[model samples]
Each structure stands twice: as C-alpha cells, then as structure tokens.
Target: MLVEYNYVIICSDRDFSLDLKFRLKKYEDLAFVSFAKDKTEGLFVILKHRPDIVFINLSKNAPEYFKMVVELRQYFHNLPIIIGISNDKQYVFKAIKNHFFDYWLLPYSEWDISKSLLHAKAQIPEKTEPKTLCLKSYRDFQYLNTDDILYLKSDNNTTCFTMKNSSEIIAYKTLKVFEKQLPEQFKRIHQSYILNTDCVSGINYGKNLCTIAFNNSQVPFSKSYIKNIDELKKKLAQSAIFANK
Candidate 1:
C-alpha cells in the first residue's frame, strides 16, 4: 500500500465523537483530525486538516448537510470523501446526488463501517512509487529493488544499505544525496539512520528507538526527527487490520 498518512475529520457532537472513536479504536492508521459540530465547523476543519475523509452528522440537519458538502468542492481541487451518518434512509438520494462516498447509520455497525473502510482503501491506487533504485558510481551502476532493502545507515560520506538477505552494500554518497531520491517508504528517523517504514516491527517512544521486523536491531531516533517517526507509524498501519498483540 503506497498510502501516506490519511487524516480524517468527523462532524458531530461530543457523544457521537466518543462512540465513533471507540468503534474505530483498533484502526491504528486512521487519524481523527479535529472536532466539528456541523457543516460550519466541518468546512473550517476540512480546510485546516485537508482530511482524506469527512464524516458529516445528519442528525440535526440533513438537507443542509448535503448542500454544504457540494459547495465544498469549490474550495478544494479534489474534495475529500464525504460520508453521511443518519438513522433514517431518507437522505440516501440526497447523499447520492451530493456524491457521498458512503453512508452510515446513527448507531454505528462495526461490520458496515469495516466494510466501507476496507472498500475505500482498496479503491486507492498503489505501487505508484519507483520500485527500483539505481546507484551509479563512475559508470558502475548497481540496481536494487527497494523492497529487498531494509534500512540505510550513514557513515561520514558513505551510506550503507542493509538488505533483507542480511547483506550490506556501501554507496559512495552521503545520506542526504539519496534522501530525496528514495520513495516515501524510506524515512529519515535520525541523522545517522534512515529505515524502511515497512520493516519496522516496533517503536519504543519511551526508549526513543525503533526496531526492524525480522532482525530486531535497534535504531535510535532523535527528538528533532520525531515527526518523521510519527509518520512512519501511520505508514506501516496502512490498509490492514492486525490480530491483537
């Protein structure tokens, strides 16, 4: 899944917010961007967060809710998916006309919500990033499949590549040189370390460290690059559910 961190905005009251949060507690990927009580507040939150999905509460007002979302298209080049939440099916036609991605009942159904989320995730295209990396050192070019590489470590001017097969290759380039070249999956967690987000098995915030999935080798992350590490967590959590640990 080549998905970045997906921000979510929910427009509802305090009680609905709490219920929704509890139902989606297991999904480590989805981010609840902010609190929005209605269309007025939702529009502001949507602009600020640029959320990928917005849940509109139709409890108080249904027709106006649909109209507001249609008007939102003018604000964004690509408007986020608007999901309507209501007890009655009366707003179904309006939701369809307004182009809502999905609809939910007031008292949420775990199964229905799960299906909608998974369906939406599958709709997103993947494998858009370049999978192969070419390292050229004076016409001696080496091609590496990005999936086979686990992490990168910098030592002065040279960068070390740790492969999934436990082999290492030294490149005659600074970490900064390849930082921008690599795909989004490669995150610079520290000055000396850049790990593949896919290979991360554990993140210990208290210890200020992350460990690879297969090897369990620890990588130290500094406070300055903590946000990168935070984004990494969301990356790994993309498009899937896990059995409870």
Candidate 2:
C-alpha cells in the first residue's frame, strides 16, 4: 500500500524550487507539499506542517547551510531528509555523515528524484500506526509494538518473538525477514538471534553473550558478528551524548 506523506522544500533558488515542486506533484502519494525560500521560512513551514520528509538545498560555500541541516536533525530526530546540491563531492560526504536519506544533484532528472522519494518513503513509518509491526502466522495476524519486543530467535525456518511481558510469539518467517521489518533498535547479533538493543542491559565480550533486561536471557553472539556489538556500543554512546545535549 502506498503511504500518503507531506513534504517541504527549502530552496533559495526560486526556479529550482519550482522545478522540484512540479516533479513532486507527479507522485500521487505525496500531499501537503510546500516550499520555502530560506531557513527562517522553512522552519516555520516545518513546524506548522510537520512534514514526513524534508528536502533542503545545500551550498558548498555556505557553512551556515550545513549548520541549518544539523539544527533540523536535532529538532526532528530520525526524520527523513533529502539533500539537494550541485556536483559538490564535499557536500555529499557531509550529507552521508548527517544521515540524510538521499541526495540529488542539481538539475536532476525525474527518475532520480522519484527513486529518492521512494527510498525516503520506505524509511518513514506509517503515521497511522508508526510503532507497531504486524506479523502473520497462519490466517491470524499479530500486532506488536516495536519497543515491547526484547529479542527474536530463529530455529530452523521459524522465528520466535520474545516480548517484554515474557510472552513468546511464533511466526512462520525467518529471522532475516523480521530484521528488515523491525526498527533500527533491532540488530542481528547472531545468525539465529535478532536483539533489541534498548533491552540490552549488559554485554560480556569474554563469554560472547549479551544480557537482555526484559527476560534476563543471555543471547550469544558469533565471532563474525562481534563488529555489530562494537557498532551497537558506539550507537548507544552517541545516543547518550545526544540526550545530554
């Protein structure tokens, strides 16, 4: 199903803004599309509309432009942002560092913008039920809150969801499938287990085991997956620093 989303373009160049607005109109799933000529007006539009996606044009010479993007990230954590630039390699690297969903070169084709829009759409959770995942088992469907899930274990072809309440739900899908559907908090620590990092209380690297707070289960991580644990630690540290800020 196509999800309807609102988006705003913050571009100083009027001609480029108009061209982008025109291209975006072709997507029937996009709605409440608006434009702003500068950061001041863009902030107002963003606060008023709370758009699902934001497209901002970045100038290589303008340090303030990059600062504005960083401020937006602080205000709207995890909101999908697309960067627009003109053949600037430096800006591309900065965009990637800031976790912009996608970037398009100036005078981009309809296909290029469309592809970025599709990617941004996929990153955004559905507004109606943003925090829930629907898992199918036989003819019945199970709705689960992403936060309530502690971890998932795969045995043969089946995957088991271990919830915060200590209840388990068996689904007929592989752990690989759930890895994609779950939010960023979920990570594959082992070939057979996908863990929710939020529920992780401790990690014993010597034992190759991590403890989950929800059920106090010691899930093992593979040697090849040790890098995932390192990355998770970095992510947690960054999150802490951001929270303090």
Candidate 3:
C-alpha cells in the first residue's frame, strides 16, 4: 500500500511561494493540504489537515519563528518534517538544535525541495519482523529469536540478556555488539540497555519512562532513552497497521 504525504506551507512572502508549492506537488506521492500567509492561519491548517510535513519561513516579518517552532513542537512532535527556510546560518543552527529534520535557504530550486522530501521519506521507519540473533562470548555462544528477548542490559564487562522466559543469558559481548545483532525493532532504551520493541507494553511520559511487560518479567525504560522509546512506539504503531491488514 502507498501512503500520501500531505504538506502545509506557511510563508509570509507572496514571491516564490507558489513556486515552492508547485515543486512539492510535483511528487505524485505528496499532496498539499493548505497554504497560509501567517502563523495563525498556518497553525490552523496544520491542526486541521494534520500534514505529514510543514514548511515554515524563518523571518522577522513572519512573527516569532522561535515561538512558532516551540508551539508547533508541542502539537506536532510526531510529524516527520518541520523544515525551516532561511539564509541565516545562525537561525538554521538554532532550528537544527531544536530537532527540525532539515533547513534550506531562500530562493531554493525545485530540486532542493525534491531532495529534502526524499530525505524526510527516508527517516520514517518501515515495519519489519524481528530476526534470530546469535552472539558469541568467551565460554559459549547462544542463539535466540529476537522476539524471545525482552531487553539486554550491560554491566561492566558482562552483558545480560533478559529473555521472555525470565532466564538471563550472561555473555561477555559489548552493548554495541548486541545492538548490531538486533533488528530495527530493537532500540537502545538506556545507556546500558537495549529494548525489544515487541515487549514494551506502554510508556509513561510523565515519568519519562517505559514499561516492557514480558510473560513473567518487566523491564524499565530509563530517562536517557525516552526519545528512543517514543520512536519505537511510533514504529510499533506503524507495524500494527500492517499486521491488521
């Protein structure tokens, strides 16, 4: 199945506005929902259409770009693209720090928009099944299907694999080694822990933590890994959609 990418363009300037819109529309997969002249109407369109991407102009005349970014971040945190357009390097740096997917200078060609749209598409995670992972250690090596593991925790020189059966597998493998062994659904949820997305039952955003409930065991989601938890939730949601089909 193919999904349509919807976009909302919020530009204060009339010049080059339609050109940009036209460029985005050229991709048959993407469709424009609304175009606004100011931040107020821009947000209205964004909320109404729930666009997959939003292109905003970073200019003094376009209200407070920083405030707009902050406000939109709250409402559309999961939206794949929040592109800031400006020629100022300082402004672009600030936007990047705030976690906008990409930024571009003004008077950009259609090719630039095409390049960015492609990049944003690449960022969205695709749904896939977990694979069996085998890791080697000094004494012995074990192989288990990825879905059978709850999480992996590293302590000094020993890395422990918490299995769905509540049994622990102690291996001398580093955290990085196991990370590479797992699939995309396996996420690093803590400095010392890598999570199995399938095992995570729910997340507590207020506590900045996640709860991975296995058959007889539970795993904790740490503060440092909250972002990865959120991302994994989105991937799991996307996977569920496919499974239902």
**What is candidate 2's local distance difference test score?**
0.79
What TM-score would you give candidate 2 relative to the actual structure?
0.48
Full-model lDDT for every candidate: 0.80, 0.79, 0.75
Clashes of each: 0, 0, 0
Question: What value of lDDT does candidate 1 attain over all alpha carbons?
Answer: 0.80
CA deviation > 4 Å runs, candidate 2: 1-129, 238-245
Best by TM-score: 1
Candidate 1 TM-score versus the reference: 0.53
Off by over 4 Å in 1: 1-7, 125-245
Name the candidate, 1 or 2, with the larger lDDT value: 1
Model 3's number of clashes is 0
Error of 1 at 161 (Å): 16
Residue 35 local lDDT, model 1: 72
Give one digit per residue, the lDDT tens place, for model 3 in 66-95: 566677767865755788887665586678
Best by lDDT: 1
Q: What TM-score quantifies how close candidate 3 is to the native fold?
A: 0.47
lDDT of 2 by residue, 1-245 (tens): 45688888887888877876777788999884688878778777887788888777785333555666667666776655555566555577777776777777756777887787777787777665358999876788879998999999998999998899999999888999988888777889999999998888778889999998867889999988888899877776775634331
